[model samples]
Target chain A: MAASDAEAPGMRPWILMSPALGAVVLLLAIPICFILVYSFWLRSAVGSEQVGFHLDNWVEVLTDRFYRDILLQTLRIAAISALLCILLGYVPAYFIARSTTRHKTVLILLLMLPFWISYIIRTMSWINILGVSGALNVFLLWTGAISEPLQILYNEGTVILGLVHFLLPFMILNIYVSLDGIDPNLVDAARSLGATGWQAFLQITLPLSLPGLAAGSLLCFVLGAGTYITPMVLGGPRDAMFANLVFEAIITQLDWPLGSALSLALLVILGSVVMLYTRFAGIGQLAKSFR
Target chain B: MDETTRYQRLLERFRNGDLERRTFLTLLGAASLGAGLTGGPLKGLQRQALAATPESVRFDGWGGVVSEAFRKYAFDPYTKNTGITVIDGTFASGDEYLNRVKAGQEGEYNIFHASGVFDYARYVNLGYDVVLNEDNIPNLQYVMTALMEPFRGVTGGKLSAAPYDYGTTGLAYNTEKISKEEMEQKGARILIDPEYKGKIGGSGDWRTRIWYGALATDQDPNDIKDMDAVWDAIRAHRDLALKYWGSGAELMSLLAEGEIYVTEGWSGRIAALQQQGHPIGYYDAPNGYAWQECLMVLKGSPLEACEELLNFMLEPDVAIAVAEGQNYPPSLDPTKVDLGEKIPELPAFDPTGKLAGLTFASPAYWNGNEAEWSKTFGRVQKGY
Candidate 1:
């Protein structure tokens, strides 16, 4: 009876998990399998897909200098954007975590307000702020700061700026979670031992927050690398990311095989990043940020 | 054989006393069970047994004033008359829209406001087209033969789309910055001019880029022998361009804000800007890019409902109203229909109805090279 009871518990967990396992298999794994199969097919001259096993798409993706350069550029942009997010995000997060204010929930709620607006709208809002006749230029011209409006909207810098805007809250929230988890007594203990406030923070608080910072960086890098819209909306002709190439392949060129290959390439790279992060930072810290 | 023929054969066999009563009954029951389980004709029967009328039909189009006009003049009135809902959707570009339609199920996308004969040919080749009964859409007679003929030629004399409007991708310049004489003199070459560097914008569309490139190189767009020179011209334009605007709204915004001094612009969008009192001057260069828009009924659509909607949209009052509202000239031949005053004043207005003056891309030529040129253009546009 005891052996049967033990087996029942094991089977109960599996039964309980079956729906989620089924969902993952049906929604995620199956679609990826389809994409993998499509990557081997050939696109006909007439734009319809030719069903066959072919290595042409994979060969081009792996060997082409164009794809390599675009992929490298995407990684570079994503790294810069993530680093910028860290530098800009840590201060507000520290303040919020160490705050003695009563309306802390309100502050956090305000931080989440940007999520209420569409991401595309938020990306596009930069055009109104940074365009030649936009608010910044208008304000600058009104103050006689410059004789002419600065042409500032469509460029690589603006694309990064848009990414940072979209990703800042995520960084702040993750870092804040890390900061909040550190015991206040640790800083007090350091301070009591003749350490300055700065020394206490550097020695105690910053070290504890490293995991959340890494998690936020991972999230930001993966998202920034995968973005197509920001560059399409606020970027110059030369500021396209890796995702835009996939878009051009599938939509403009009607080459689904090439697009599928390119997309899988991106997925593998980003997935490797996540796996590496998991190896060091115990992926559980990523979930703590949401809570 | 069909279910009816099989049933009749079974009945005849039984009446001829070729089978016992119990054996006949067993065979009939087995046939019924097989038909129920295996479907085939039963699926058709099930569909026929369902609703005779569809609840709603979907129509996708370019947004902004175009959608507004259709809503106010065409779809809204059609819905009011027929007691059916029109689900209006918007697409940023034809390529993006085609990708979406390809990914979706048949009948999910009932109609599309498609651009150009090449796009029609692409759809036909992709097998997304549906034949419309001409007798139902009686108002198709008023459309210009010039506009209709190209689409017909693409589909081998059967149209999957009704030509609705026509426009040109002409050079739009900031009038305050560039003189009309300079624009006319420079023509397509102005986009590649060194002085206009960092002050020019162009459509991000591959076809528009290639079309302008061909013109800049003094080659016919329909038949380009030296593609290297055209590519060089495109490279020059790319280096000089400030931005590649994606939508009509962005094109107007760029010209209106003076961010770009010169770029290829849509005739109707430029007209809209001019009407808004922006200092934008539109001049179609010699051998300029001209194209027509069509309302295409996709396969698996409820044919009668979509036909009714097309007929309503093609009416003189609705077409003229939409034309004036969106600033594109209607497909109605001015020689046949009195298209009122505003359409006559619109950009790319074809009073002659022959459209002999405007040059259009040959579907065979463009669609034939779509797989290669479109992919190559993607690389070239990004500093290749």
Candidate 2:
């Protein structure tokens, strides 16, 4: 091939990718750099910030037992929510993938409907469902199942529940795409060879869909861990996550420097998880599910 | 050299044919653009045009009924009288709003209805506080001297804000669960009462929590000799609390829905609950949190327009209507301005106008300990 011909193919991809790369650099990378710079500054007694190269915020964020506890709690909540999403989402995903109905598009459309409403509104809707005078208690009262309303809302459980609610669609869609891509002949062959339906699913279908499941798990876990709103709205005082600590530091304490450090700390930890997932499962699988 | 002399020299070079026509034109264009961008006559002209008539001024407040009152009485009428639109915004707390203001560009936040003298002091300390031309705001005379004194104390005897309203973070209890007599007797101690475990509620704000914690420990909130006792008291409240409600709406909802039997709630919010016929009672326990809210004009606001709006808002009719609407007493000294019948009936109304009964937060003491205490409270709140 000519030198120009060889260069054209390589340059074409770069030219095509430039806009997206520029956007990511502008929106994500630049802000992160600013946060990294801000993490070293100091917040004074009167809430005024002193801009300098100081390690107080970093030292505190690294050494503080309080931040460590909240980080662990955040990870625990995110993992629980991701597991719940997988458990609840997989059945729907499989059913949708295998559906012979003409209204399969409608099912996918219905799944996307929740995204139209504001996330804050959706998180807050739990209040109407689980509040003392809410629908659940009233229904329970009418059914004569209990003497009083169950104090079910505003706990770690509700925070996880809210996370699952917000994240289930992503999980379902990812798994559904994976299941849809699976060859019917593979499952049919497994069954034809005297394998039972469950065995066929376990061996042929489930193993093939692992990439999508991993992708969904990563997305759900990252989103859940990074959420401050779910805990602020649905969780009790003790149920605050790592994001809530960043929020309190920045907003309540007016300690932007500390908030920056805390946020970076969270990003680094979550980034390690992403790196591990990429190393094992391959990052291309995540892209494949979207495609 | 000065920009003017440089511009003249460039013009002379251009006219004398020492510079090519294209180069002269390019240089002239660049110089004009630079002057425009870097604050020359063009920028001054833009400022003059904007000041001639500001199209809109933003006014952020605590939202819910408070915002409704401002929208109905103050902002809507102000817009009607003058064409300047009042852009109504809301914040969950002063801290949240302050952080937003810090992140935002100048003039993005115009005026805020801020609570407490500490908030005013913080703004002053951050240099966001604007020295209002009080002579333009004729209605300043009607505001209580006591309310204005604290703000003046913060800003060195010049007001950055007009005293808007006053209320307390008083003990609000469910009348069905706890009697008025019990609330009055138990006072701040009702929060940490073991009998009300899992049934109690409290504000999530560190200041309010710490203030009540001080009262529960029987230590003066303004001067705490033992910090550990306050933290312990707060920890006890945290253990017992059903949820530390974040906003006025949440506080009202918790009480109205019977989620919590007792909480330290905003005086206005609790009054709103009472008016909604929720059987909620309010009591100003000894040294209950008495805070004054202000119409603080921020540094980069349209000064003359903001001053005029401040004056209009403080008008007795407007102030009284807002007071009745929000269920908070207007800062219009009841003695100076004949505040309507309902004004006196509001939760924290001080008819005497002296405000000697209400105990306000000392700005110096609170702001001094703000960084340390707010962080500590954040830890203690999350089960430290």
lDDT of 1 by residue, B54-79 (tens): 57889999887778888998899998
**Residue pairs in candidate 1 whose N, alpha carbon or C atoms collide under 3 angstroms:** none
Model 2 C-alpha lDDT per residue in residues A5-106, reported as the tens digit of each score: 989988998899999999999999999999999999988777878889999988888898888888999999999999999999999999999999999999
The stretch of ten residues in a row with the least summed lDDT in candidate 2 chain B is B43-52
Model 1 per-residue lDDT tens digits across residues A142-217: 9999999998978899999999999999999989988988889999999999999999989898888988898899
Judging by DockQ against the true structure, name the best candidate: 1
- Model 1, residue A127: distance off in Å is 1.1
Error of 1 at B19 (Å): 28
lDDT per residue (tens digit) for residues B195-234 in model 2: 9998999999999999999999998999999999999999
Give model 1's clash tally.
Answer: 0
Give TM per candidate.
0.92, 0.92
Q: Give candidate 2 misplaced runs (Cα > 4 Å).
A: A1-8, B1-53, B76-82
Q: List the pairs of residues colliding in candidate 2.
A: none
Tell me how many clashing residue pairs each candidate has: 0, 0
Evaluate residue A227 in candidate 1 and report its C-alpha lDDT on the 0 to 100 scale: 98
List candidate 1 segments past 4 Å from native.
Answer: A1-4, A282-291, B1-52
